[model samples]
Target: MKRIGQAMKRMTVLLLAAALTLDPLAAASRQEKALAETKAQLLSHIAVLASDDFEGREPGTDGESKTLRYIGKQFFDLGLVSGTNDPGHPWFAPVTVLGREPATSRATFSRKGKRVFVLQQDVLVYTSGKRALVENAPLVFVGTGKTIPSRADLAGRVALLLEAGIDGSDRQTALIQAGAAGVLTVLDGDHTLENVAGHRQRLGYALGGEELGGDLDAFIAGKALDAALAGTKLSVKALQDRAAAPDFAPLAVDLAVSLEATTRETKIHTHNFIAKLPGKRPAQGAVLLMAHWDHFGTCAQPPAEHLICNGAIDNASGVAVMIEVARRLAKSPQLDRDVYFVATTAEELGLLGAKAFAENPPIPLSRFVAAFNIDSVAIGPAGQAFSIVGQGLTPLDADIAAVAKQQKKKLLMDNRAEAFVRRQDGWELLQHDVPAVMVTSSWGDVTRVEAFLENDYHRPSDVVSPRLELGAAAEDVDFLTALVRWFADPRRVPYRSAAKPG
Candidate 1:
């Protein structure tokens, strides 16, 4: 028994010595250090982009010049070829847009010859380029703003449209194409009058230079609209339900709308920066990654404090993720298909850069197998599932799911997918039949997304905060890096022949 006890003590001492020599915690320490370093790198870029020096990275400002230079320089240093065909320099594709601001606006809604609303309070004309002068134009309720039959005569009338879903832009375009003089969209969801007004006024746009416009577009608050339609033949709810149902006829409201607006237009030239890492088989197709680098610029109306609207999470985080992902892709072995990185400008200006790129792709649109647009990522906890916005828009969800599974993460379908789909740059590409997906980290606490939207969205308060977990963003970077790797593998083809454009 004494010998056995001594032998056991000796074995314990030997085991302790082996552990000391092996440095059992060394690998974990290295991993921790590497993670810390990556977080620092991501935060560094966010700090620079969201800093006052970038001036909110607004399009057509001096901030634009700085932003373009910064992105171009980074791409050049990365040894990426300019995807642009510029003779002098290849990184830039210029997109010209008109920035219009309303000088004076007036609108009135009357029911049965009784005035129901006055401009600047109950009604606001948010869009103005050319003067819109209409006196007592008859109101026609077009169901959900869908395309009207060509035979329908909509000349010299104002169309009351229900709020559309992901296809809102298409519906609005259809309304204009149907020869409606103007369109008034009802507010949707739990939005207040002041909130709606602020949301509308806060929006700035970069309208296509060649785009034709003569119609007025405005939004009416849901509550005020309800009050206006109380005594009418068509209640607001009935109109909404009718618009939603098929075989619904256009209801001629008991009201007419009068509108007038004056505006100032200025031209601004911004660009989308494109860079490419060539693949082993260039003809197969390319995987595209995109991120918008522009922010709100300086506040349109500066408050007493926080003059700059630093869009840290709004986009700087996204751009940083794009850069880091690009770095990883560049370092890896040659992918089966080329990878193109586009850092777009004027995204806040109604996705103008993306629209411009899709209209005239640096490479043929047919060669693009898929596109992943990175925006507003990982503001929540680490290891949360990826929220695939606009999940059913395309078959790309399968690839996202596969990637998520490989990364040991789950996929969270966005409940408000359409709202995000119509708003992001990816949707601009999707309209052209390109398989694109907008990805964000799942909000483990749903309030995180709501809080950001209610408080930080488009505000100066969007700057980086302690609440922003860089560790979560780092996890997103890893996931995206893995996604790109899996997406570009020669053995795998996510696109079916039916899905691929010839």
Candidate 2:
């Protein structure tokens, strides 16, 4: 009996040694298998979402209905409950959107009670409402519109801004906040007035109840400004040169501008798909994952062989990544804080849905531990470095860096991707002091991203194909899974004040 016992112990020891030797290899195999499955899943989701039948997933269309059903079904199948917490529409949160297009617009300029004779074609006037009128508001040249002159009482006055690569939305918002009755952007860059007019002629959308008031937003041709200032000391060229000075201040142009714009408004109803994985400690802060699911529908007119902008890489890939990450997290052990998933609507239309959600959140915005946004995440190949779009703006960078290190992924520490921060859904949340970031390997390769943007982005050519590089996107899914786990752990990432990071 003693001899038999010794032989059995030796056999057990050998088995233990063999198991130890193969564990690393086994783990590696499992990881590779998971990655392959993630890639396949990503492709499957993108194929369905980017299919011609989805009609580019435009909001408030038959395409949007189909998209909502598909995304809701996916969340339901994953055993996630409604994050919106509305029992009547458990899986969806309603977002009312208003679409407006300029029908008729005209602007007139006067100097010393004499008509300046500015051509109507030289200026494009637009409003966020049905009608807007700005009568005889004096024009004050505010240089680049980056700063309002303290001495210049801009109340009820028009602020003329030199277009010097400044963001139009930010410049307009700044001037509006400073009590400017109207804003006019002069076209001084590569973009011609015709190009600007062509782009703005289309229907613009914003969330309901958030429309612009009687304030005027107009763009003027530089020549028109020069014509209005003709025989005066200030010319467009002189004003442009003066704007280059560091101490440039607002200068009163001897012109009074009167403008009237009429818009045709239409109301579109859309919904944001929301699902949640309940955590053990419900009172703890939650982690949110978001991706916009809307794209331009029927972008091309008839006679074009392809008429739809499938948005395969623009956002189908992003939604797929979000879905897969949710799936993986749902299957893992319960997290301490809830993980919420939102597929927002009308992101292509100025992030209307995201704005609505922020304005009226299911949970208090302060309860959100961290938020990560994914967009156009299928451009780069595998092994590309990852970038945080909101890199230096938030305090979540250290935790994100830790996860990247653990995953053996290279993280670009530069804030170059911050240029796109205001262009995505995260910007809306960030405006509300929510900690939001977009971590993607695709944006790390600026060349590939730029090529995609210039060539296929928002065009009919953005379709699903074998050439859609999804390797890095799959890796991002894995990275996000790890990130959510890290953030959802109450013990690791404790709840902090939700103030915007300085």
Q: Compare the candidates by TM-score and give the number of the best one.
A: 2
Which segments of model 2 are wrong by more than 4 Å? 1-28, 108-124, 136-153, 156-180, 183-193, 218-257, 498-502
Clashes of each: 0, 0
Error of model 2, residue 12, in angstroms: 6.5
Instruction: Assess every candidate by TM-score.
Output: 0.74, 0.85
The most accurate candidate by lDDT is 2
Give the residue spans of candidate 1 off by over 4 A.
1-28, 103-153, 156-177, 181-204, 216-262, 300-303, 413-419, 440-445, 494-502
Clashing pairs in 2: none
lDDT (Cα, tens digit) per residue for candidate 2, span 1-502: 9999999999999999889668998778877887788889999999999999999998889999988999988989999999988888788999989888878888999988888898898898877678888889899989887776553568888888888432347878678778888788898878787777777788877788885656578888888889888889998899998998988878888899998888888989999988999999868789999999999989998889999999999899999999999889888999999999999999998988899889988898988989999999999887789999999888899999999898888999998777789999999999998999999998898888889989999999999887899889999998999999999987888888544221
TM-score of 1: 0.74
The residue-level lDDT of candidate 2 at 103 comes to 88
lDDT of 1 at 425: 91
Q: Which ten residues in a row have the lowest lDDT in candidate 1?
A: 493-502
